[model samples]
Target chain A: MAGENMVGTVAIIGAGIGGIYLAAELGVAGFKLRLHDIDDARLADVRAFGGIDVEGERGGFAAVELATSDLRAAVDGADAIIIVTGGNAQAAVARSLALLLRDGQIILLVQGNTGGSLIVRRALDAAGCHADVAVAEMDNYPYSCRRLAPARIRPIVAKRWLQIAAFPGNRIAAVHQRLSPLFPQAVAAPNALYTGFTNANAMLHVANCVANAARIESGDIYKFYAEGVTPAVARLYEAINAERVAVAAALGASVPSLEEWFDRVYGVREASLVETCQRLTYNSDGPYQATGTPSSLEHKFITEDVPTGLIPMVALGAAAGVPTPAIDALVAIVRNMTGRDFAAEGRTLARLGLSGTGVAEIIRVMNEGFA
Target chain B: MAGENMVGTVAIIGAGIGGIYLAAELGVAGFKLRLHDIDDARLADVRAFGGIDVEGERGGFAAVELATSDLRAAVDGADAIIIVTGGNAQAAVARSLALLLRDGQIILLVQGNTGGSLIVRRALDAAGCHADVAVAEMDNYPYSCRRLAPARIRPIVAKRWLQIAAFPGNRIAAVHQRLSPLFPQAVAAPNALYTGFTNANAMLHVANCVANAARIESGDIYKFYAEGVTPAVARLYEAINAERVAVAAALGASVPSLEEWFDRVYGVREASLVETCQRLTYNSDGPYQATGTPSSLEHKFITEDVPTGLIPMVALGAAAGVPTPAIDALVAIVRNMTGRDFAAEGRTLARLGLSGTGVAEIIRVMNEGFA
Candidate 1:
């Protein structure tokens, strides 16, 4: 493989909360690291965080010295590329990377929201790259971090078991072996479908936030992980989980229950889901604080999550004959409120170039794990 | 016609705004009147207002003797009963009236919400007194008055048209003949179904109030008839109108558009619907102020209107395969907020003793008129 010597070098795109923490973690673990973000302000903030130190205790750190404006230049000689850009920015960044990335480079999406890996793959193909790059996804970043300022990141929790999978199911083990030393929580998920369906943040956050729009709009600063999970809210959480499960089943992915996934991610034993969320938020060293941007559920819950995440699940649920009334009502309400038909938005099956396949065929392809 | 001797005497139940103004209007016109209410204090208030005097001009003078009671005494020995009890008090008053009402007496329900005529009819049947009583309904009382205190009613707008009908269509002309002299614009509706379906207040108020619950809770109050009729709010109004039309179609009833109904009811040649509502509220010489209750929409909109009025329309819409997404979502959200399954609590075809009938059968029964 060309650039085999660059195996330990890592490139992280988009220095957002997720990208910054991962770069900090991996850089401190002795990996040669390069951090890049489109926002100049965000890039400056990362530079203010003492630059990525790559020669430290976790594995023998390598300082993160390289930062770039050009996406292609950022991933030119890197062994692994970790993408943490916004969902809107994903395709463009992927296109740029595909144009310059060489063979055998690993492109790992920290959170493959709305089939970001597939989108990236399509963009790469469009850019005419023939390299056999390993494209994979990790469902979501395995840590909870918040940008306290333009520069400072305060991580709340480092997840212990993060389910990761390569594009094709057969190559997951190989990817895990390479990433295992860096992510102690790394586990080979059944396929990309498993990762896609197991996105609890999107599932839980969307419903809770949307339903409580009144409370949120009134400037009731909600500790989302703490006070947000009341009994009624927990029922909403379960409903969302049910939708995710239905989608996973329809896609032939072996997904764990929300509670089980919670345990795996938090490394907590015998903790109820609500209690776990509460404990995380109420913790003294936790990232949650009294002030932040208005967590308008309209955007995160209805606009992004419902259309990009929940609608797909709902479609799959309908295909599988799983009645998801709560999810359906939510989708309808959001549609009414926003005056938009989310079902026709981007990443839908029709938009994804896979409109004709039946549920069974879709499941087979998802299980086989191709972009 | 054994009760023809007593036919000229009008019994008004509930000495609230509607009851008192209706009694005053009929009484001043030389009809013997008896006013009844559960609240003794409210009865004293009506008595203090000089009963009813209908001598000079429109809003000139009125004085009439009234006997008030809990329920039993209200319906006893009366020729025609006009029910103006609180929405929540309807079932109880209906039950009591069934026990005391004599054969051939007329029971007219103002604000004939969600099968109000049927509710009273069923109660009479249950009481084993299925006599030759004419159960009739009016779209609403002809005046709007407010109980400013225990004994003071501030008159608002007296309606121009008072559409009256009997439950079985046959008695509509006879019923209209008896009631028309008191209302200059009195007209015979097709049947009780038409009267029930033309309740514009219920249709417009419920959806807007429930959808804007957050704003209401935040203490934002606006003249519901005026400022609340903005474009966004009007969309909800249109949705409700559509549902009402669907219900009317299901029952084979002729339903008028809101604009047409407003023009007919208000007797204004060029006044828009919103303008009529505004004038009804602000016009001092109008009867609406004198007979209308508090401007709060919660009781009429949420409690009575939703379950009694809207749900029936929803059920009919379901039977007719017409989509009422806006209504459905509003009902669901209100039910969630209030912790009630309004559908089960609401009036339905089965509740009205027409469960298994086709539209033709219902039409035939309505045409035959109630005895």
Candidate 2:
């Protein structure tokens, strides 16, 4: 594989579960690795342990070639910098590496919200730094994992499939070729817009948490997708999916409905969205078995989903003349419920530097790749 | 008082808590009472008991005078007809009385949704029953009471105040004069629009039920407002309140904020909305203390609230160019959760015969009252 021949130093940013597991897999593939994060305690644990111990199905101790709190040293000679944090951490990570980024250092955001690349690029530009670097995002991480301890990670499941798109979308093949060893089932996505709408994390989680809010905050442990997404909540997920699909249509991007997303991702063949969700949620080996209901209404389902998920969709739908009542409704509820003005603070087109641009311009920018 | 001298026979519809209590109070006030309902079992109990045996601080037996399942016979020569039931049941009662209603009879809907009058008016007109019946509604029921048995209604406390309005707007004073004996502290509302905006049951219940969905479904028995309205849920309630206020402003109507409503009603001078709610909810005599947390999301909190409370609000806000994202979102959530099309099926401008009208026309209709 080209990824093997092209193997070189790789910097894994954010010492989260994804970062640790990614490092283990890539280390097993024989690439020199570096782990970086602002979490000093976590970094110290990684430093003390000398590397991450990944368990569950794919168990291994990947020796650390380097572990550092320093961002520059992490990427000094790396072929690529893989960011494995929530979209919430993307901008901060971007700013952290703004002045330190180098030429030919590709940056990839695993399961980024749309505009994540633009944000990093803008940070570099603001720092008066220019480099010959390619940037990309995946529709999802290839694994659903969590940290068992600061030095250990549990790879719950190898998600089997992922869609990748490069900013300046023409680089998908070249980028995919170099990244294939780590993500064996990687496929080329049409554009970031496609990946953006198709990112099912927020789509499924937010609606389920909101619909089953009582259950989630009831202090009872429950499976999120199985117990939270009753037949009724499933219908909401469907409507929200329809709105996302409509936004894609407005942008001239093609993606599967949320129902089909579950089908494609988990490889389940079911007649309805609820049935498919029920199956995936209850699967013992699946990632959701490791997930629990958010303790209250103030968790990531509202915090991450609002700003990154529904907010941009609502704004884009408004700009595209497609109504997103369902998305807008959730935004309002969370905004009021949380005292956060997500609409004012979220990932708007203006924030993404695509304000006042039409659909063609957006699609054109996505495909042509920015300089 | 003029209401005492003007009192004649009165028909009490629905035979629920409010209906039974109203019968008891008016029967003590020396007016002949007719308790009418389609509920044969409840009606049979009322008939066998011959009158209601009331308990609590206000204790005594008040003769029913007449208990019947026959709607026409009950209202044959009534001075006024008081319909006491959930807002969801209002339409059916309207249709049942559509053809049988006579001239000069005053029909008061205790806490009927605004559309309740419009629907009954439309029903009467559709039935070719052109009569001078004055259809009216109250801001809320005059008591926090429930039926212990079919023959017994325990009114925990008398709601010291109520605001009355009639459909034709001009008939308010006459209706008030005839109906005020049962509602001693009743005052004439500027219009039905004011009363509609101030209906707090849905706004508080829906948000609390949704935010505290876990606790309710967990089989915990608690007072709804006191136990469920955490700071976050209180914020959602405030948003919903703001949206309701915006809708009223669009209609040129003024209503108290939910916070003030609780203050005025409960006589608690609490500073925060949550604190006020907590106090009122824990007060043994407060209306809310009489209410229990909904058993499930499927209860009236979502079902009745979304349709009767939020659907009309979203429609009115849209027609008036007022953005009601908070109300719209709750409607979407509940609609999907219940598999119901509340917006399409619930009260709307079209249903209220104000579909294509602009803001000025809406205000005009609200002030002038529809004939």
Candidate 3:
């Protein structure tokens, strides 16, 4: 049915790099588009340009059907909604969508950031919006992109593979059917649990960032991955990744080791994780090349990732009865460094509405509905 | 009294900076010295020079009665045995002394790195030595010195104050009596627990090393304290110090906060730990100015300090039921960085012969002996 009647009108929220890329691709592909961002300046640029200019990989002056800062008008009658506001804004976006969303609509988080769907679903329930909508998430953004100008985006490369799944995973088939056209590389994941655990960025960013805390603060310009991920740092990555894999296993989710993921995804056939990172840093034209290390400890690598990435993993590990000592230690250290208690302020399972639930119940809720 | 009849003969172990500095000072002070080192080359240099050439502050041609590679010959007939072989060599030195030591000879660890006295005493007991020797420890090396050549050293500066304590709290007076003549600034601590917890080096080294791990590995030459102790890194130091203070409190050992210690010891008054470190680094002629950042993670900042310093602190904290989450986290991170399971390989409470004991028992042992 999804193949027969490909959802025509699409709502793209958050005019960030990912959101703009999604809009440009879908708009050029003949799907009607409405783009929304809380930043009026960005929306004004989009409106003035009449649409976004796409370059590299995909090229077109993709016109939008609607560009507005209005939340309700953006998704007024769209068949599908793509949220790319990042993990920090996920809860607020979810709350706004809860009131405007109609029945038979689909919501997808561009990158779930470890339990994005569950968090959005919980926010929807809390706001008393019980619309018959399907919520889904991808492991990461489909494109590595940058905004050249206000309304100009360069999509450097589209990811070769991604995992997509809906909350209460039974609905993944329907969600995957619709998403596959836009994301040809996406394969249906068993559930959001699979997608969440496969978030390699969560495991990768924090430790390396912490390891290079002084370099970042010293106002020195250096390659984050190339210079930062030394042998010891790479070893830390392996250690943290092992803990992550154990937690995933305890939750009945299968995930690749960080080394395996790097090898499989990047085609970096190095002897160790350290070599893999070094190879990817110098040789690849991927996100690693485009990315800059955080300017301060307050940057997203710690501020956003600690709460959305590590804290959630720690909470999930605790609920699953799997020890995440390395991850837990990281959270404590970050807390000390920043004077912020991530466990208290972060995305705990309780905040995601999975409190008092054991491993079996968590897996059950993840596969089935919250009911 | 100690002043009435001072120890006339002293055995100096290891020919490192601390050993050479001790030997030079005591030899110039007119006490007979026998210096021992496993390295025959260093002994050859000392023999060739006819004695150690001392420079800076207290300069003299300090003669050694004997400088040999033989451990038994080093300690034979010496009234005081000074172990300056560093923490790594503590166990082997203790075992060797167990066989060679005689009655009424005092054994002192130059820098008791958080339970050094206890570990040495345990080794002696395990080796079945029942000599009436008082095993004592000082909080840190008395002089911040460097060796210019074999058998030649420059005493940078004597520590303004140092804490000396015996294994049992009650024997401190006797140890202090002999030690004070050599170390005029030395004061009596309640017990080795007080001296151990007051070890500011262990609290300061690892976290800052980890924060600048990539920099250290990159082989970039920089001042360790000035460039490395950025704001976030200083915050980590404070957090670790807090944990150390709590563990000390639980064991009835009082120690200064890192900030307080900086002010009291270095006379660098500042608003925060960050400012204090910065002031000391740029303004003072102390150890911070002279010490270079480690070339690799395998340096003593991680390798030597972790096992002998942090591991013991964590063990003591555990015995006292004090949760050292930050310190424990630092240990885990260091373990990850170095590929060493510090908790397993480094000192544990059980390893120090303090297993199956609670807070009250630990404090009791600190005041009393193993009996």
Among these predictions, the greatest TM-score belongs to 3
On a 0 to 1 DockQ scale, where is model 2? 0.50
**How big is the positional error of residue B333 in model 1, measured in Å on the Cα after superposition?**
4.8
lDDT of 3 at A23: 85
Fnat (0 to 1) per candidate: 0.04, 0.56, 0.84
User: Candidate 3, DockQ to 2 decimals?
Assistant: 0.77
How does model 1 score by TM-score?
0.74
- The candidates' DockQ values read 0.13, 0.50, 0.77
lDDT tens digits by residue: candidate 1, B10-67:
7888776667667766765677777887777777756777675333245444554666
Question: What C-alpha lDDT, on a 0 to 100 scale, does residue B1 get in candidate 3?
Answer: 17
For all the models shown, what interface RMSD does each have? 5.8, 2.9, 0.8
Instruction: Name every residue pair that clashes in candidate 2.
Output: A168-A369, A214-B213, A214-B214, A215-B214, A329-B329
| lDDT top scorer | 3
